[model samples]
Target: MTVRAANAEALRRLLAAEPVLTDCVSAVEAIGLEPGVVLHAGPPIGWQVMCAPVQGAIVGALRYEGWASSEADALELVARGGVRLEPCHHRGAVGPMAGIITRSMPVFVLENRAFGNRACATINEGLGRVLRFGANDETVLARLAWLRDEAGPLLGKALRRSGGIELRTLMAQALQMGDEMHQRNVAASSLFVRALLPSLVREGTGAALERLTDFLAGNDQFFLNLAMAAAKAATDSLLGIPGSTVVAAMARNGAEFGIRVAGCGARWFTAPVNTPEGFFFPGFGPTDANPDLGDSAIVETLGLGGMAMAASPGAARFVGAGGVAEALRITEEMREITLGEHPYFRIPAQGDRGAPVGIDVRRVVTTGITPLINTGIAGRKAGVGQVGAGVVRAPFGCFTAALEALAADDG
Candidate 1:
């Protein structure tokens, strides 16, 4: 028989229990209500000062919504402060990549009735020339149109017919398929393709099917953002828990990298953001990379991305293709500051033990082991998109100050 306890402590343990997938869904669920909802990039921003990626998405959205004839016209309205700019999380949504969510766009909706909340995120249409990454070229705009007309409707209909796919199941399986669920998603992408096939096949085959296959094949990193959204869904549930020291979010916005600790509520401790070291596509080099940006940090909260480096040996190219031993060593160092092993994702080499579970505030304070981040490098200058990708660490000063503040609070 299962033992029951009556107390806040018990509740904390219980709430933190359940598979990671459940927690991930909870974050997505927290965002509530409807399509056509405009989710912006970065923190809450006024109508003015929206970044390029978000701006690009907004422009595409105008076209998607039949509100504007061209991006130039769309820019005029956005500049004139006509359409609304809202936070994605506020509307039960999350955006991966460039993270621009607009109303009328089809989103993968995850609902948690137990908590009376829902989370939504736009589909990952694979990589390149897509709006999320700030690609708003004519071809990109045309593809977005096709997605809204062909891909979106067909997939949305199939999803609706199937009554929605559970993301937790996909998360659980993806880890096994070589997805760190944050930095790498090869396995998750495969699993997503498999789960989506039956439904996709039913939507009927033609240029659409061919397009779908090509989309999946072309964009290998598609599911990382989805998993990050799901992870965001999960970690957000743990927010505002009384006296808990868990971290709710960790992210960067090109200018700064920051994190939130559960015990302190919504305060963020940020460090001067640094550049990533990654292998670029042909003709690209270190000079091309941009400093990291975006809010898809929900990945780190789930214990992948930089936390599960051992799972992503191939990530070295971005982080500095040094050696597998160095990669293993970096992942192992994560244990120095982590709390426990993730009950859901287990490292194959660790005798199937769960991947390093939590990032402990105490460990950070005591050991001063800042977390490592493997990220794509974007150009510092605007409009360059991604120049490279690689690994970097949380600026030590950020952790030291945050830890010091936490210590003072306890004292």
Candidate 2:
């Protein structure tokens, strides 16, 4: 291994590309849902990740499906042997909070034409203790119903009318506006709202219009999930890329940490999950934090999240804000280890260069640096759920294994 860096043009050819987005049916197979199928994560979970917001969301979904009389029944069914829990990602979907995605839920679909793989994610619930974060209560449930009955249909109608929102441009815009498009999506959400306004206004038939206005008025985080989904969809391109040592995805549950490599297909290399070290909410400390959950880390691998931490200093409060200079340095440091840079997510601070791209296992092994993850903290005690969110680094062992695997394959 050598310490030399490639020239700019060489780096450009080595990395810098965008994946495509397509419909789930045309893109993904067997694992994805058709129009009629609502996917559920059965057992094991027991809604243990069940925070109040998520419980309310699950109950709302059950209610929406006409399967339960009230939320009480929904909870009862979830607790007993009645209902099934499913990972939204399994069915070509991603959700926020409990991220319980339903079948009819309109999803943003992305395809990797180069590799013949695809990924999907549900829209974000925006900020607050929304159901995606596992918050269950009247406030959370009512909001869920409104999104289902009002926002969901209206947005779908708008998309139908206005063709569809092109995610490529949106992601590019988000990067310049200080979003890595994964952990930090403020700018992307604002842009998405602006893009959807015309359709929302057109579909505003009395109640729909009123709901649309209300949702937009208060919800700044609305587009986060879409941004994450799009990133997830885009990064899937690196999957199955032969001889490439890029890090495609990084995710964790409270129990384990995992990484998927470009050369390894879908097989996950996992390590024991560790507790995150950073700031916490008032009245809560390290004791309240859960390990980690969700597939959102895909955004980081795509050159967002902590990698683009330079763009969003305000993100520090949410994840134990680092010094401004330190944040900026962090993003710069990532290039030493990454395999490529994102084609769409360019950083203004970097003179409009795309954000540091695909993570190279070889680069990481050679440089001895691990990936940094900024994640939401879930409570280990279940029911309580979501203590706070913060930036944390992934264990080096995870990357080491991935590098070794990629190296062995090269031989």
Candidate 3:
């Protein structure tokens, strides 16, 4: 089959994906994550070479799991190979920056009803000093414990009671309401809360309910993890489509950026990650920013994050990506490298045009336009948490290499 035909088929499968929030459970239960084994975001890397934020997250996870009594102990344990590290993507999951998932952590499960595949992601821990951003303080661990012990179970029961939330519809509605489902998810988070509130009210009571509601209300990015899981499930459905050059995943490990092509199976093409260029938090600047990192790029793979930028001019401005004109330019440029537009994820600002989808390595290499990712910037130092938010391009090297691999596979 021609690459074009294969890519079309892959896009069709991806667009047809129906990811739903089926459950929330411990990572061990949801993904069969073994004790002593933890998943971090992006392509696989060992403990020694992992970025400080990822290492910090691991240390935090070890403490949260009670496998280590202190940060020093956690470091020692890792040095001794007492802990195992794997990429969340390898296990059908995704997470944001320093995306660490421990065995006991509660993970949201997304099942692709159309494809019968599932993906999972940990709950968002709000903003600053969170585990995902490498903050390992007692406070961070405490919130994680609350998520696992309280919020996870409650959300799971609510999901079951509501017969699971259909994410595609919700995401579409969110796009229309000014969410690109990556850097800015305020509308999506609100809609998600609304969808679960009725069921959540039916499932919990008193202070617990109040706290959960408060947390949800406070975290405008709470829908991000859910969206990541949904994206993972949808994109995973496009894997291994013979002759397809469509990018199935794009992720960063802080140290490296990687992409997996549908035609090339699970093989990854990687390059040095780029530091995101955008506005930083108070007291932070370019020197304080880490390279782009996160499995959240999966949303872009499914054509909803940066690919849907035209749908959220506010998100563009918030991430220092300029105004509506720049947003429109970015989305239009994205179309040059993608196979088609997402049917449901339309941009109202662009006359309700569908968001570009199906990143094609051939088109990227030919056009010299890499995929733009909307992402959070972790502090260069571990445990410092998020420093800013911005846009970064998936390394052009990754796409060129992927294109070569696709050619070799076809040959």
Candidate 4:
């Protein structure tokens, strides 16, 4: 088949996806994650080559799982191969920075109702000193434990009682309400809390309900994981479309950036990752930033986060993408390389136009325009947590390599 035809079919499948938040469960329950098997963000890599933040997260997970008693012991365990590291994408899941998901961690489950495919992501731990950003102190561990033992189970019960929330509709509404669903998820998070509050109240007592409500209210990024899961489910539906050059996933492991093409099966095209160019936190600067990292780029693959930038002009200043004109220009430039616009995810700033969707590798190679990703920057050292938020471009080399492979297959 022709590249255009193949991409058309892939786009059709993507547009048909109907991702819904079906349930909440442990990583093991949701994705069959086994003991000693830890999933991290981006393409696979060994402990020796992993960046500081990822190594820090693995150490935290090891201690949290009781597989190791200390950071030194955790490093020893990883060095000896006592712990297995895999990419979340390898197991139908996605996660934010550091993106560590252990067996006991709670995951949000999203099912693509139209395609019968599913994907999951661990619950967001809020900002600052969180494990996702590589913080593993007692405070971080304690919060993680609370998520595993109390908040996770309660949220699961609430989801069960309320049936399931349809994510596409929620995301669409959020886009209209100035949320690009990454870097800035304030509107979606608020909407999600509003939807689940009644069910949570029905299932919890005074203090438990109060704690859960407070946590949800305080974490404006609470909906990010759910959006990641939804995007994963939606994009996975387009995989394996023979000859299609559409990008099915984009991820970073701090050390490397990678992309998977729909027609390329499971093969990954990778290159050295690029550090984000944007603002940093107080006392933090470019020198302290880690290279872009996370499975959160899956949202970009499905055309929500950075691709929908025009929808959230307020996020521009926060992520250092400049003013409204820059945001609009970014989205417009994105359209030059995408296959089409998302039918459901409309941008009100663009006169209710759908956000661009289906990142086409051929178009990217031809146009030399890589997809922009909205992201949180992790600190260079272990345990520093999030240093800032910004916009980064997926490595251009990944697209060129993917296009070459696709052309070879066609030849």
Per-prediction tally of clashes: 25, 26, 0, 0
User: 3 or 4: which has the higher lDDT?
Assistant: 3
Estimated TM-score per prediction? Answer: 0.81, 0.80, 0.99, 0.99
Candidate 4 lDDT, 106-209, residue by residue in tens = 99988899999999999999988889888888999999999999899999999999898888988999999989889889999999988888888899888877
Residue 381 lDDT in candidate 4: 97
In candidate 2, what are the lDDT values of residues 1-411, reduced to their tens digit? 221232232234324334443332211232444432334321124457433444555776666555677878876776675665655545545555456666545555655443455567665656655555555556656766666566666666676666666677787877677665555667877887788778667766786687677766666566566666666665555566566666767766445567877667676777766677777767788988766566677677777788777766666545775767777788888878875566656777776666776677777777887777777776555345557777777767787887678667767
What global local distance difference test value does model 4 have? Answer: 0.90
> Cα lDDT of all candidates, in order?
0.61, 0.62, 0.91, 0.90
Candidate 3 C-alpha lDDT tens digits along 209-322? 999999999999999999999989998988898999999999999989999989988888999999998878899999999988999999999998888889989989988999
Tell me model 1's lDDT, rounded to 2 decimals: 0.61
User: Per-residue lDDT tens digits of candidate 1, residues 324-363?
Assistant: 5776777788888766676666666545666665566656
